[model samples]
Target chain A: MKTIGLYKYLPIEHKESLLDLETDRPIPTRKDLLVEVKAISINPVDVKVRSPKENVEPSPKILGWDASGTVVEVGEDCKLFKLGDEVFYSGSITRQGTYSEYHLVDERIVGHKPKRITHAEAAALPLTTITAWEALFERLRINSDDVEGNKEKTILIIGGAGGVGSIAIQLAKWAGLNVVATASREESVAWVRKLGADEVINHYQSFTEQLTNLQIQEVDYILCLNHTEQHWESMGDVIRPQGKICSIVETEEPLNLNVLKNKSVTFVWEFMFTRSMYQTEDMIEQHLLLNNVSGLIDKGVLRSTMNQKLSPINASNLKKAHALVETGRTIGKVVLESF
Target chain B: MKTIGLYKYLPIEHKESLLDLETDRPIPTRKDLLVEVKAISINPVDVKVRSPKENVEPSPKILGWDASGTVVEVGEDCKLFKLGDEVFYSGSITRQGTYSEYHLVDERIVGHKPKRITHAEAAALPLTTITAWEALFERLRINSDDVEGNKEKTILIIGGAGGVGSIAIQLAKWAGLNVVATASREESVAWVRKLGADEVINHYQSFTEQLTNLQIQEVDYILCLNHTEQHWESMGDVIRPQGKICSIVETEEPLNLNVLKNKSVTFVWEFMFTRSMYQTEDMIEQHLLLNNVSGLIDKGVLRSTMNQKLSPINASNLKKAHALVETGRTIGKVVLESF
Candidate 1:
């Protein structure tokens, strides 16, 4: 089988940063679904794992996470999925990724692909959708079922034009929260507004000043998709007393949690790989949320975040995707098809 | 009116640390209840606020929080309590405390006293009960209504012999979670176990070592009643992926939140005074929870944690209580009756 992977982590400018390889095809086993991947999406995690590192891989290490594919084979214990079924998922970090001809994912974490969208569009939705959904409903524990309750609430989404933030703004709006999103440029600001953000603020400016100008006193929840360390203080300042904050970014410095102590704020991390990394009891929650997102997408309550596409899922196209993600200004998702 | 307070922050050993003074009696207004104080309890917060400092108060600053008394007057807007009603409450930090012969408190944070317990016992319960209740059921968001579901869950109460932990063990047991409480001494271990802790571990030793010995893998929830800075890493290690940790203890230094990122753990600060300090819209929830706690106490599902008793609330007795709390090893609560 033809696969794309890295032998050594290097800058994207280097030709050897990513390579095309011939590896033996993987097999399905123990509740696994052998996915014949059709489309792949690039995320910031791809750029991170592919960045310059001191270590070298013994074998080419696959690095993609989001994919849309067909089930070529099913493990004996798999109960939710079957061979020939179309699926979309963000595979576990601990497992081999989706940058290959055939990929294995646990059936429990895979969701049926949205029937209304293209495979490329479906690929773009999984990782961002899973992250935004979990960050909003699971980590922040917003009662999505209680629209009436959320009608009185507000959510501040940092980095609004990014893949996860775009979908998150819509989801928060759909859940009836007043959405305040941060975007630095005109295109990004307009993009988030078009995606249903009620208000927009520039990330380059003072959050309190912008919020004060917009008449938003405090937010009930904050979903941080940008640099958490940089936004930590501003978030603590704007978050309502007893409010909740969820972040996906890793911090380089220690957090003074006492800043939020007087307000009794909640701080939660939302790593999408948590379930797969820990093999948690509720690993199936990912499958459920992804399926819910798919249904919402098909029903037109949500939209796909795929913005840029390339063909032939080879090293050249993947390198382009990685470089775009590394810029940290890509508005939505970038995908590659036809592996 | 006779009142015990401090003009200057000083060590408990100082004669003027907590002085008996004559202050004007307070009047009830706008949801306030003027209570004729009967008994008051000492908590760690008292010791902290009264710790040695260079600054002096312009007027005496009263420090008591947990109190059981009879309402002598009610404001025009007060709807929850009537005059002469027996009540127990952990009043707001912003208001005058219960060290006075007459004290004013908001009606919404007060609860009907448990008929089964004495005034001293009731006084001991308010602060610890409110902290334990809010941390477990509110901050950690444990589903107290689902006993069957909670049967599969486990909660680790760090500092099991403290005032909050004594009641938390009972509440966690009532909610059907397998409770693992950390206690260092023979008496403390026996105390938590008697209060319905299913397992007791020594906090003086490595938490992982003790939990491993108990055949426990990880906890679904952790209520940190002790030093969070000291126990942060241990709590992170023993918490299940996506588990919650709530702490009332303030950290001496900034925390490295990255340790729990892989597991997507939640860290929440549980300051019992948050609602009152912020005048949050849900301040009345305290009244509701305390009433529920009162019912539980009366039904014998929970019991008061009043371990030591003193008579005639005065400067000397308060200094003694402060000294006991300053030791940081006082089991349960110390209450003084008859102001």
Candidate 2:
């Protein structure tokens, strides 16, 4: 089977950073679904993982997490998915990822793809949707079922035009929260507004002054998809007492948890890979969230966040997608189709 | 009226650290409950507030929080309690505190005194119970109502023999969680064991080794009443994926929040004064918890944590109580009565 694999971690500018290879197809094992990959999406994690590192791999390493494909085979222990099931998943970080013609993934983390969207569009949804869903519903404990009660509440999304933020804005709005999103660029501001953000602020400006100008005192929740270290104090200043803050970005420095003490605020980190990495008992939650997102998409409540699409999933197309995402200001996701 | 007041923050050994003074009695207004103080408890907050500072107060500052007294008067807006009602509360830190013969507290922060206990016993409870209850059920989001479900979960309470930890052990046990508490002394270990801790370990020893020996891998919840900086790494090491940790003790250094990122653990600060200090919309939740605690005490489901009693509340006994608490080995709360 053909695969896009890396022999060494290198900058995208280098010729050998990503390469085309012919590796033996992965076989379905216990609870594994052998996905015949159709489409894949590039995220920040893919860039971070493929960035420069000193050590070189003895064997080729695959590094795509978000994919939409058809399950050609399933392990005997798999009860959730069957053969020829069209599915979407952000596969586990610890396992061999999805940058191959055939990939093995735990069926418990795969969800039936949305019938309303194409495979490329579906590929764009899994990673961002799962991240937004878990960060808001699981980590921040936002009661999506209690829309009426949440109507009076608000959430501030930092970096609202990015992959996770694009979905998070819509989810927060769907959950009946007034969405306050931050975007430094005019295009990004317009993009988040299109994604259901009620208000957009410039991230480069003081969040305090911006919120004051908007006649907003404080937010009940904050979902940060940007540099947490840069926004830590600002988020602390604007987060309401007893509020919650969830961040996906890891900080280079230690945070003064004291700033959150007086307000009794809760700070949680959301890494979508946690469940799969830890193989937690609740790993099936990802499958459930993806299914719900698929349903929501099919129902026309949510739209695919695919901003750009490339055809013929090869090393060059994958490289192009990676380059677009690496710009760090892409409005949404960049997906590649047809390996 | 008479009060124990301090004009300067001084060492406990100072001659004028805490002094008895005559002052005009305060009147009740706007949900204020003018309580005729009967008993008061000294907590670590008292010692910290009275700790030496460079700045001196222009007027004597009265410092006490936990108290059980009879409501001599209630403001017109106060419907929770009326005149002559026996009540207990951890009064707000912003207001003049509970060290006076006549003290004013918001009726919303006060609760009906336990029917089964004396004023001194009840006095020992309000602060610690509120802190423990909020930390567990609210911050940790432990469903105390779901005892059957909670039976499968466990909590590791650092400093579980201290005032807050004493009540936390009992509450966690009542909620059907397996409670593992930490204590170094023989007497404290015995005290926490009596309070229904499923197991006890020395805080000075390695928590990892001890838990491994006990056949416990990781805990679902961690209530930290000891040094958070000292235990931060160990707590991070043992917290189950998606677990919750609440700490009352402030850390001297910035915490590396990234350590808990992979596990997706939650870190919440539980300051009992948060609601009162912020005058949050949920300030009344404290009142509700206290009333529920009162009911629990009356029904024998919970007990007061008073360990020592000093009569004729004055500078000498108060100073001695402060000295004892400063030693940081006291097993339970200390109550002083009869001003």
Candidate 3:
């Protein structure tokens, strides 16, 4: 099998930052599906993993998470997926990734791909969709059933033009929340509004001031996809008393949690890999959420966030995708398809 | 009217720390009840309010929260209680407190005092019970409807012998969680066990090791009634992935929130005053919870934690109670009764 991987962490522009390597195809085990990777999407995690680090790998570290593929073989214990099934998944973070020609994923976290979407488009949806879904519905505890109850609620999504934020804006709108999204550039601002943001604010400015100018007092929820530390105090200032806030961005500094004490606000971190990392009993929830997202996408209630695509899954194209994501300004998702 | 209050923050031993003062009787307004206080309880909040500081108040600041009293007058808009009805409440933190002979409280946060309990016992309950109930059921999102489901879950109550922790142990037991409480002293351990903690561990030791010794791995919920910063790392370690943690104690320093990222754990602050402070639409939930707590006490499902009492609420007795709580080692609660 041919794969794209890193033997040592280096600048993406450096020669051999990513390499074309030959590896033996892995066999399916209990609850595993041997998937033939058809399309792969690049995320900021890929850039972070590929950045310069002190340790060199003994074996090449394949790094990719989002994929749309076909199941080539299924383990005997697998109950959900069958051979030749078209599937999409944001594979586990601790295991080998989807950059290989063939990959293995637990059947419980894989979902049937949206029938109406192309492989590239489907590949772009899984990771961001899972992140957005879990951050809003699970971590923030947004009530999806009560549309009337949600109509009065508001959510502020920082970095709203990014992959997860694009989907998050839509999901929050679907849950009937008034969506206030932050995007610095005009294009990004227009992008979030197109994705259903009720209002757009500048992330570089004071969030409270922007909200005040919009005649909004405070937000009921805040989903921070950008810098957590930089926005922490502003989030504390703007979140309603007893309101909830969730962030996916990791902070470099410790947070003064006492800022939220007087308001009795909640702060939750939503790392989408938590279930898979811990092998939690509810790991199957990922499969369920992906299926729900697929249904919504097929039903035209949601759309894929595939903003850019490259041909032929190879080291060069993967490196290009990584470089684009490293810029930290990619609007949605950048995908690669076909070997 | 006679009241005990402080014009300046001072050492607890100072004779004028809490002063006896005479003031005009306050009249009831819309939704207000002019209650003749029969008993008032000292909580940690009283100590915090009286702790030495440089600022001096223009007028003396009354500092008591838990009170049991008879409504002497009801405003036209007050529908929950009539004149002469005995009620107990942990009133709003923003309002003038319950240290005065006549106290004015909003009717909505008040509940009918348990008929079976004495006024001192009822006073001991309101502040601690409201804190415990909201921390467990609201902040932690414990499902009270499914006792069978709850029986499979576990909760760790830190500082199990404190006022809030005592009531929390009982409430968690009522909600069917396997309750593991942390208490250092033998008497405090016995107290929590008597309040229905299934097991007791010392908060000074490693919580994970203690839980492991007891054949438990991790808890589904954690109610932190003591220092959050001190136990934060251990709490993160012993919390199940996707578990909930609620705390009434505010952290004095910044917290390393990134530790809970991989587990996607929730951290919520439970200030019982949140609803009243914000004048939230759901403020009546306090009334409902207190009424439910009253029923539980009357039915003998929950016991009052009034461990000490002093007659005729006065400056001296109130100061004494405040001094005890300032030591940060008081067990259960201390109540000062009728003037």
Candidate 4:
């Protein structure tokens, strides 16, 4: 199998940053599905993990997560998927990633792909979709089923132009919440607005001031996709008393949690890899939520977030995709299809 | 009306730490209830607020929170109570506290005193009960109604011999969860065991090591009543993936929140005064929960934690109560009754 991988972690500008090589294909085992890679997407994690580092891998390290593929084989223990099943998943961080002609993933984490969408589009959805879904419904404990109850609540999605934020805004709105999104650029603002944001505020400005100007006293919840450290105080200021805040971004510095003490607020982290990393009892929830997202996609309630596409999955294309994502300003998602 | 107050913040040993003053009785208005004070309990907040400081109050600042009294008058808008109704409450931090011959409280934050208990016993409950109940059922989102579901979960109550932890142990046990409490002193260990803790760990040592010695790997929830800064790392180490942590202590130093990111853990504050301080839409929850607690007390499902009581509420008695709480080793709540 031809795989795009790296032996050395280097800057994207370097020729040896990523290389195309032939590798023996892996076999499915114990609830695993051997998937024929169809299309893949680049996320911030891919760029971060592949960044320049001192440690060198003995073998080529595959570095991708999101994929839309067809299951070519399944282990005996696999019950959720079978041969020839078209599936989509953000494979476990601990495993060799989806940047290959073939990939192996636990069937419990894979979801049936939306039949109505192309593989390229579906590839852009899994990682961000799973993240947004869990952050809203699981971490923040939003009652997605209770639309009437959700109508009285409001959520602020910081970095609304990003991949997770784009999907989060739609899902929060679908859950009947008043969705206020943050986007600084004009195109980014328009993109979030198009995705059903009830209001758009700039992340560079004071969230409290902006919300106040918009006549929103405070938000019931906040989903922070951008810098957790930078927005910490503003989030504390604008979150309603007893409100919840969920963030996917890891902070570089310590946080003064005492800021939220008086209001009895909640701060929760939403690391999408937590389930797969820990092999938790509820790891299958990712598969379930993905299927629900697929259903929503098929029903035309959600549109694909894929904004840029590259063809012929190779080291060159992946490097380009990585470079684009590294800029940290890419709207929606960037996908590469067909090896 | 006679009140115990302080014009200056000073050491508990100072002669002027608390003073006996005569003042006009306050009248009830709006949702207020004018209660004839019967008994009061001293919490750590009273001691902290009375600690030596540079600022001096023009008028004496009254200090006390947990109280059980009779409603001498009710405001026109008050519907929860009427004249001569016996009440128990942890009044708002924003308002003057319950250290006088007569005290005023909002009806929404007041509850019917337990019929089977003495005023001092009921007085010992409100502040700690509200803190524990909110931390468990609301902040951690533990479903008290689903005993069978709760049976699989475990909670680690840090500083389990304190007022909040004493009630938390009972509440968590009643909810069917395995309760692991932290206590160093032999008396505290016995006290928490008497209050229904399934396991007792030493907070002075590594929680992970202690729980491991007890054949428990981790806890699903952590209710931190002691030093959050000191226990922050240990709490992160012993919490299960996707676990929730609720703390009532305010950290003097900033916390490295990144420790819990990989586990997708939740950190929430459980300040009992939040609803009343913010005048939140759900401020009435305090009243409703307190009444439920009163019923539980009457049914013998819960018990008061007051282990020490002082007679004839006065400046001298309050000073002694403050000193005891300042030691940070009070086994349970301390109560003062009968002005």
Candidate 5:
């Protein structure tokens, strides 16, 4: 099997940052599905994991998360998936990832790919969609079934042009929330609005002022996709009493949680890999959510976030994708297809 | 009306710390209830409000939260209680407080006094009970009806001998969760166990070790009634993946929130006054919960936490209660009856 891996942490521009390597195909075990990778997408996690760090690895480490694949083989104990079944998932962070010709994933976390979507489009949807879905519905505890209750509520999505935000806007709107998204550039602003943001504001400016100009007092929820520390105080100020705020971005500095004391607000972090990393009992929820997302996409209620695609899964294309994500300005997802 | 108030934040031992003063009786308006306070309880909030600060007030500020009284007057819109109805409540933080002979409170936050309990006992309950109830059921999202489900789960209550902890132990037990309470002193341990904690451990030691010794791996919920910053890392270690945590204690320093990332654990602050402070639509929920709590107490499902009582609510007894609370080691709650 051909795989893309890194032996050492280095900048994406470096020659050895990610390289093509030959590896033996792994056999399926209990609840495992041997998947033949068809398409893979690059995300911020890939960049963070491959960034410069001490302690070199003994073996080449695989570093992709989003993939649309086919089950080549299924373990005897697997109850959800069968051989030749098309699937899509953001593989577990603690194990080998999906940037390879073949990969193994637990059947519980894998979902059937949308029948109407292409492999590249399906691949781009899994990681970001799962993240946005779990962040809004699970972590934030938004009542997805209560459209009437949600109509009066509002959600602020930071970094609206990013992959997760593209889907988050649609999901929040689907749940009947007023969506306020932040975008710094003209194209990004238009992109987020097109994706169903009720209002789009510049992230570089004061969020409070933008909200005030729009005649909105405070948001009921905030999903921060970028620079949590930079927007911490502003989020604290603009969140309603008893409101919830969730962020996927990790902070470099400690957060002053006291700002939310008077309001009794809730702060939660959504790391998409938490269930898989901890082998939680509810890991199957990802499978359920992904399948639902697939159904919604097929039903035209949601759309894939795939914006750029490259030919053939290889080290050079993977490096290009990583470089584009490293710029921190790419809108939607960049994927590679066909090994 | 006679009142006990402080013109400046001073040491509890100071003669002028909590002064005896005469103030005009306030009239009830809107949803206000002019209650003649019969009994008042001292909570940590009283100590916090009376703590030394740099600023001096133009007028003496009253500083009590928990009170049991008879409604002497009802506002035009107040339909919950009539004149001479005995009620207990943890009044709003923004109000004039219960240290006075006559105090005004919102009808929504008040509950009918338990017929089975004395005024002092009822006074000891409202503040702590409200905090614990909101922290467990609302913030932690514990299902009150899922007794069988809760039987398999565990909740670790930090500071189990404190006012909120005393009520939290009883409420957690009522919910059918195995309650692991942290208490240092022998008497405090006995007190928590008597309050229905399934097990007792010292908060000063490693909580993980205590749980491991008891053959427990992690807790499903954590209600932190004490210092959040001190026990944060320990709470992170013991919280199960996808578990929920709620706290009433304010952190003095910035918290390292990344500790809960791997488990996707939720941390929420439960300030009982939040709904009333914001005049939230769900403010009626407080009235409902308190009425339910009153029923539980009358049915002998929950017990009052008043361990000490003083007669005739005045400057001297309030000063004594303040001094005891300032020690930071008071068990249960202390109440003062009548004026």
Candidate 6:
């Protein structure tokens, strides 16, 4: 099986950062599905995990998470999926990732791929979609079923053109919220607007001022996909009293949590890997949500977020995708198809 | 009308820290209810707000909040209460407080007094009950209506013997959650146990070790009533993945919020004053929940947490109650009754 593996974490510019290797195809065990990788997407988590580090792996370390693949085999305990099922998943951080021709994932965290989209497009959806879904519905506790109740509610999606933000804008809109998205660049702004953002505000400007200009006093919720530290105070300023803020970005320093105290705001971290990493009792929620998202996609309520696609999944193509994502300005998602 | 007013922020020992002032009775308007104060309770907020500082008020500044009284007058717009109606409430922080012979409050935040308890007992409830109920069912999103669903959930309440924790323990228990409360003193431990805490742990010790010893690996929710900065990390350590943590205590410094990121944990502030302070659309929720609490108390499902009571609400009695609460060791609530 052809795989993209690394011996040591290095900058993307380095030739040795990612290498093509022939690794033995892994087998399925206890609720695991042996997925033959079809397409993969690059996310910030992939870059962060593969960032330059001093530690070296004794063996090849596979380094991808988002994948759209076919389940070639299933373990004895697997009930959600079967052999030949086309699946999509953001594989667990603790397990061997999906930067290989074949990967193993727990069936509880995998979803059947949206039949309406191509594999490359499907690959772009899993990681970001799962994150946006959980951050909106689970972490922030938005009642997605109550469209009438959500009509009066508004959500601000920070970094709206990024992978997660792109999907979050759509999901928030789908949930019947007044969606205000932040995008600084012209292309990014247009992209988010196209993705169903009712209002677009620049992330570089004062969120309060921008929202006020748009006749929004404060947002009912905020989904932060950019630097949590940089937007911490701005988010605090614009969130309504008793509102919720969910962030996927990891901050470099401690946060001044006191800023939100008077408003009694809720601050939640929405790491998509949390369920798989902890093996929580509700880990299967990811599977369920993903299936729901797939159904939404099939119904034409959501479009694939894949903005750029590279063919023949290889180290070079992944490195190229990594470098593009590293610029931190890529709109939507960058995917690689057909290893 | 006789009121306990302060001209300067001073230590509790100061002679003029609180003074009895003869003031004209206030009239009700715009959903306002003019209540003849019968009883009042001293909470940590009162002590904190009255803490020593250089600021001086040109006029006497009143400082108490929790009150049980009779509505002497009601504004034309006030439909929630009428003249002679007995009520209990924690008035908005933005308004002059409740340490007067006659106090004015918005009828939307006032609740019918529990028929089973005396004015002194009811006075001990409003501030703490509102804080606990909001922290549990609202901020933590625990469904008190879903007792069967809550049976599998567990909550660890820090500082179980304090004003808010006492009520939180009972409310969490009523919600059918397994409640673990923290107390260091033997008397405090016994008090929380009597309040229906399923288990009692010492906050001075490690929560992880204590819960593990009790065969509990982690809790689904944490209600923090003590110092948030001190328990932030420990609260993160024992919280189950995707768990919610609600804190009433303020932090002295920035918090390392990253500690909870891996678990996708929720950190929410449960400021009892948020709704009323912000004049939010849901400000009336306090009135609704307080009425629910009153019914619960009348039904014997909940009880007043008043422990010690002082007679003839005067400056001297208030000073003593403030001094006792400032000690940070007062179990239950210190209340003063009858002006």
- Winning candidate number (lDDT): 4
How does each model score on lDDT? 0.92, 0.93, 0.93, 0.95, 0.92, 0.93
Quote the lDDT for A194 in model 3.
Answer: 91
lDDT of 5 by residue, A64-108 (tens): 999998999988899998878999999899998898899999989
Candidate 4 local lDDT, A146-180, one digit each (tens):
99999999999999989999899999988999999
lDDT of 3 at A255: 90
TM-score of each prediction:
0.98, 0.99, 0.99, 0.99, 0.99, 0.99
> Please, what are the lDDT tens digits per residue for candidate 3 over residues B1-339?
999888989998888798999988899999999999999999998888778999999988988998999999988899999988999998988989999999999999999999999999999999899889989888898987778899999999999999999999999889889999999998998889888999999999999899999999999999998889999999999999999999999788998999889999999999998899999888899999999999999999999999889888999988778878888989999999988
Give residue A13's error in model 3 in angstroms.
Answer: 1.6
- Per-prediction DockQ: 0.88, 0.86, 0.86, 0.94, 0.81, 0.90
lDDT for B321 in candidate 4 is 90
All candidates: CA RMSD (Å):
1.3, 1.0, 0.9, 0.8, 1.1, 1.1
lDDT of 6: 0.93
TM-score of chain A of 4: 0.99
Give the TM-score, chain B only, in order for the candidates: 0.99, 0.99, 0.99, 0.99, 0.99, 0.99
Instruction: Score candidate 6 by DockQ.
Output: 0.90
**Which digits, one per residue and each the tens of the lDDT, describe model 6 over residues A65-135?**
89999999999899998779999999899988899999999999999999999999999999999999999
For model 4, state the Cα shift of residue B162 in Å: 0.6
Tens digits of per-residue lDDT, candidate 2, A1-339, equal 989999999889788989999999877889999999999999999999998999899999999999999999989899998788899999988988788999999988899999999999999988889999999999999999999999999899999999999999999988999999999988888899999999999888999999999999999999999999999999999999999999999989988999899999999989889999989999999889999999999999999999999989889988888888888989999998997
| Lowest summed lDDT window (length 10), candidate 2 chain B | B74-83
What does candidate 5's lDDT look like per residue over B137-199, in tens digits? 988999989999999999999999999999999998999999999999999999998999999
After TM-score superposition, the amount by which residue B108's alpha carbon in candidate 5 deviates from its true location, in angstroms, is 1.1
Which of the CAPRI classes, incorrect, acceptable, medium or high, describes model 2?
Answer: high
Model 2 spans with C-alpha error above 4 angstroms: none
